[model samples]
Target: MKDHPLEQVRGNPSRPLQTIRQLAIDPEMCMYALTMSTAESKNIKEAMADSAWIEAMQEELHQFDRLQ
Candidate 1:
């Protein structure tokens, strides 16, 4: 079994939720962007819209899907 990205975030809960938000938010987001845009909103709206990721998050992360 592979480790989930959110699991890594759970390691240091003090780091803030925005950090964890980045992984599922924008897989392609750069390192510098994460730091620079830390204050800015990290929108997972696009990712949440993706059916595959949403299902994976539900099955793997146990987040329920109420979008339908």
Candidate 2:
């Protein structure tokens, strides 16, 4: 059987144990979640074009209104 890419880094002293554990559990899902979590629009116009960003911004605004 072929080794997984992450498996090669299992013995690397510089790699954090927690990261290896998380990736070991599900590399593909972990990578997808990381990618989605880091994805951001570079400008307001781009952010406004995405419904997810719109919802997020609206929710943030609602929180500010509620706290004031």
The number of clashing residue pairs in model 2 is 0
Q: What is the lDDT of candidate 1?
A: 0.50
1-68 in candidate 1: lDDT tens per residue? 13345432423445544555665566654454556444332478866655555666778654345433
User: Which segments of model 2 are wrong by more than 4 Å?
Assistant: 1-25
Residue 31 local lDDT, model 2: 79
Q: What is the TM-score of each candidate against the true structure?
A: 0.26, 0.53
Worst 10 residues of 1 by lDDT: 1-10
Q: Distance (Å) between predicted and true CA of 47, model 2?
A: 0.4
All models: lDDT? Answer: 0.50, 0.68
- Model 1: number of backbone collisions: 0
**lDDT (tens digit, per residue) of candidate 2 on 1-67:** 1334542332443544455467659888577657756789899988877777899989999999999
The deviation in Å at residue 36 for candidate 2 is 2.1
